[model samples]
Target: MTQHDTDHALKTGGEQGYLRIATEEAFATREQIDVYLRMVRDGTADRGMTSLWGFYAQSPSERAMQIIERLLDLGERRIADMDATGIDKAILALTSPGVQPFSDTHEAQRIARSANDLLAERCAAHPDRFIGMTAVAPQDPQWSAEEIRRGAHDLGFKGVQINSHTQGRYLDEPFFDPIFRALSDTGQPLYIHPGTPPDAMIGPLLDAGLDGAIYGFGVETGMHLLRLITIGIFDRYPDLQIMVGHMGEALPYWLYRLDYMHQAGIRSARYERMKPLKKTIADYFRSNVLVTCSGMAWEPAIRFAQQVMGEDRVMYAMDYPYQYEAHEVRALDAMELTPEVKRQFFQTNAERWFKL
Candidate 1:
């Protein structure tokens, strides 16, 4: 691997007898909260988005505001959480719906750059405990491409974190190729984190209290990944590596059905034709995607992900603040994986994927 801008090598923990590097950890900037608050105050915020943001919002509830304050912290408190969780290092990204919701392209670009600069400063302040990911607004693909280069090449961020969609714009659209090319040039992975679904698509699910992470998040994120695969994204940028949390966002369980359905639809001559991919959905996963055990601590999910995506593609994460620290770490320990497998899941795979 090439030399990374952060001092990742110097970051290690001897206390646990094994180094634990967690990815998929999230944080938000005060500026980010301010933007959302303004949207809410002006009655311009998406109602569904407002409901989802309440989970990590800094207003409306004093307790929720405390959590938001914690999310804004990247200093001693965060490090203490890591220590308690048995994690030595964490890869940090701006929280979901980052700048992706902004309708103004210039405003989105400004927020993306500012969030990245703040995250970079924090990582530089405590390189041993944190690694940063670039936040880009896919609303302006060309400008976002430039920010990706600026963040990864100059600011020491390891990769880019894209909230699943921009407003309703998913990454599979042809307009996002510039962003993909920029990421491809860096040889850095794109972390496809979840956001609330588009307004038109959120019907009924929200009424059932199945929005946010209960189900909507997985549905939206998983479909976004499938769109990337079936829409010839991997064919265009074959070297690109995509990362997703929540144990592949429930994709591993449906791989055979997805591949089979795609083939059946093509053979029936009933579906509209688009660009053809060089490989199947399952093949792209094997060659171009990685999954992390973030937020979900179920052994069956982890084992099933390993069975389908291979142990090498799996990594460990706590999801921080949202998921309990000690419980997840204890679950990882109790999985009884071989020492070598444990090392790959805990540290080495992350090091390899992020070029740390």
Candidate 2:
């Protein structure tokens, strides 16, 4: 179907007493893509990067080309796609594995700054329609912290986007405390977007052709978030808010098991890193984290997430360009949420969390 036909079929949230604010939309700059291409060519990229960006960079298929094109455009095309899908505003971030693949800290920092600048320009051009999140290279914690302050104070970005892990190093480690401090100090929520698993964990998933968004992304990112919780990140930075897409990366469904096993591990002292936390795993989720239904439009999952995560902590996202299915928007619009809850899901919650 044509874009116009899709737009016509989907009743916008405005017509249903809410505005659809898609919080996990992604965009990219050509410079960033060029760097990715170079990394793939030079054989310096990690296995996950090779599997994900290498495919995109080398694929001759029309769908791959189209996704690359869409990722590069933050102007008329992206806005039109949002309009066609009944999205009133999009909270934009650099696509996954952003600058995280660069081992050269200076190079990573430079590209991250440039990407944030370009994002700021795009958002400024259409402030009412676009909100930007800061993309930082966590390869250099101090540099990333500096960039976060600049993005929030100078560029006006709402939050910070860290694509799961940086150089196979999760943010729960002590080396990343600077970035967390910056985020807490700036009151910018951390949006942990998904990336393919690192080499240590990707071999089996890659062997099965399940290394990208199909499954590996969630498993890798969910473990990343859990690492933070178990290490008492929220207890250290009590005001640091976080967001994870794809229905909390399946975290909600496993909350009970997570709590039980986490406590068991702590009691046994099976691992040196595992320590008693200030709160249960589920409590941290309820108090510190928010979940968006990006690429997860199923009503049962959405309702279950809301029931578990609290209605206020659940929001809407389209996972644009990557999973741009107009029918997903239609499905969300057709959900049986009350007017107040629908407004919270589609609009106000994002507004409150991101300060958008």
Candidate 3:
């Protein structure tokens, strides 16, 4: 067998099987680090921002410079981690709250551009093992559209990755139409990852130590996605595709309930002036939205996602560097799926969505 075939065979339990492609992998540029540090030094960073960085870093008491070092080392350390974990390719994106933390549009755009350039360079150097997703700050919708075009058309990024909201603004707002239209025009999928909640919005959750992935990530992202659905984003841009990680942020489990509530709310004229969507919320979930098994390694969640979203819409991800558990591959392998389903989950589905 060819080397490629042999590797696939080793990964997929045969001699010429599936190649694993993790779509929700993350990285950070040194420039991004510098900007974040500047924010911290200037006292402009969000309440939990510095502490969040420290949580991921090696040092518990201060900014995890070591973790920042690892994020910047997209070359050796990251690739080594992937290799050890049986991941043949990783679709890399900027880490959470990437350029979104920047309140200045100009600064956000500059930082996003620099980060995208860095990601593109890394992917070019390791095309077989890496693919890049473009990063854009939504502070300027027009600029974000242009950057999405540039990143996908010129830099060859696989798609776009946006943290759930820009500052406190979510994607459901009409102000983001240009951004959605741009994504539609490029035919690149957009991955909506989570960011820490605005302090004012989730103060209690933050104090309860659920600010990050444990509970808050899903709560925030799940709400962001529901907002997209209720506010008619999918209705307006039918061609635009979006992805949410962490097993659809608990959406699949509540699919029927969401549909029921959506109907009930609209029928009640809850927001009398707001227009209702043409289709059920679950229709959009199956049609325009895709979900990944990022950071969530539980078997039941993955299986439930498949049940609701269908195997074709479900793909594998490790949520690398953050939830980079080595046993995840084994967990996926142990799933009660046929080889064909496994191939779709690990390879073909991502290839189809990200144009891999």
Per-residue lDDT tens digits for candidate 1, residues 1-356, read 12231212222474434688889888987888888877866777775677777445645676676668678898989887776666888999998889988878788888889889888999999988899999998988898899899988899989999999788888888889899999999888999999888887887778888878889999999999998888888888888999999999999889999888888776777757544567778888888999998888777888888888788999988887667457557666657678788788888999999999
Which ten-residue region of model 1 has the weakest summed lDDT? 1-10
Model 3, position 295, has a per-residue lDDT of 80
Off by over 4 Å in 3: 1-16, 57-66, 272-274
Among all candidates shown, the one with the greatest TM-score: 2
- Candidate 3: tens digits of C-alpha lDDT, residues 1-356: 23333233224223336888899988987677777777777888776565565355435543355456667778988877777777899999999888898878788888889889888888899988999998998888899999999998899998999998777888877888898988989999989999888766768877888888888878988999888888888778888788999899999999999999788888888786346787888889889999999988787888888888788999999887777777667767666678899889989999999987
Candidate 2 per-residue lDDT, tens place, 33-130, comes to 89888988899988888889988877999878999999999999988888787899999999998999787889888888999999999899999899
Per-model TM-score, in order, reads 0.93, 0.96, 0.92
How far is each candidate from the true structure, as Cα RMSD in Å? 5.8, 2.6, 4.0
Candidate 1's TM-score = 0.93
lDDT of 2 at 257: 99
- Candidate 3 versus truth, CA RMSD in Å, comes to 4.0
